[model samples]
Target: MESNYHTLKRNYNQLIVITHLTQLLTYITGFGGLVVPLIIWATQKDRVEEMDAHGKSILNFQLSILIYSIISIPLILVFGLGIITLILIAILAFVMPIVNAIKASNGELPSYPLSLNFVS
Candidate 1:
């Protein structure tokens, strides 16, 4: 019973981490939100299966947005086509992560589309 309780708590903990990790931009504590999940999941790999699942989801979401920004930065100057759209995309990139965190917190495994999911 103790083991089962511990497992349940750990799973919930992972969900909590995944849910709040994206709030980093909103304030500041969420800064490591991008990396901490991976670290925790890696270190406690066998302790909670949910940790690995949520961690990879969060990691990939951040990484994909990162790649999108990298590609967009260069194209912005070269094309000069849609500055407003670009800005919105940038904002969405940041906002979506937070949204994902919120969804995860509610025990929903929200998967961002086109994410790399490198950890998996």
Candidate 2:
């Protein structure tokens, strides 16, 4: 007999929302914004509804922020433009997770702007 484990799924909206909010860990402990959500997604995607989509969006957004920050470092020498870019990136990084967490709570998939498709 085949096991039904693969077909089992649960509606865990709170967990999904928590996954989105975990991205803010970077602001608090200076890291784990990516690692924490990644662990939750990896371990729960098969069991939780919408975990895959939310996880992918969060990872892509975080990766994009890292890339943007790296590129901005070079721009800092060019009339200090990188400073502005970094500030905008920081704001986006700080705000989007909270907004998406609310969306997740409402059963909506995350929509992270300017996020590159790194996972899909």
TM-score of each: 0.67, 0.89
Estimate, for each residue in 1-120, the C-alpha lDDT of model 1 and write its tens digit. Answer: 999997888677655555445435433653465666556657765766565677677678767766666777767788865466468655765676677776766667666766776767
Cα RMSD to the true fold for all candidates: 3.7, 4.6
Query: Which residue segments of model 1 deviate by more than 4 Å?
Result: 1-11, 18-33, 81-86
- In Å, residue 93's CA in model 2 sits off its true spot by 0.4
lDDT of 2 by residue, 31-55 (tens): 7899999999999888787899999
**Candidate 1: what lDDT?**
0.64
Candidate number with greatest lDDT: 2
In model 1, the Cα lDDT at residue 83 comes to 67
Best by TM-score: 2
Model 2: pairs clashing at backbone N, Cα or C within 3 Å: none
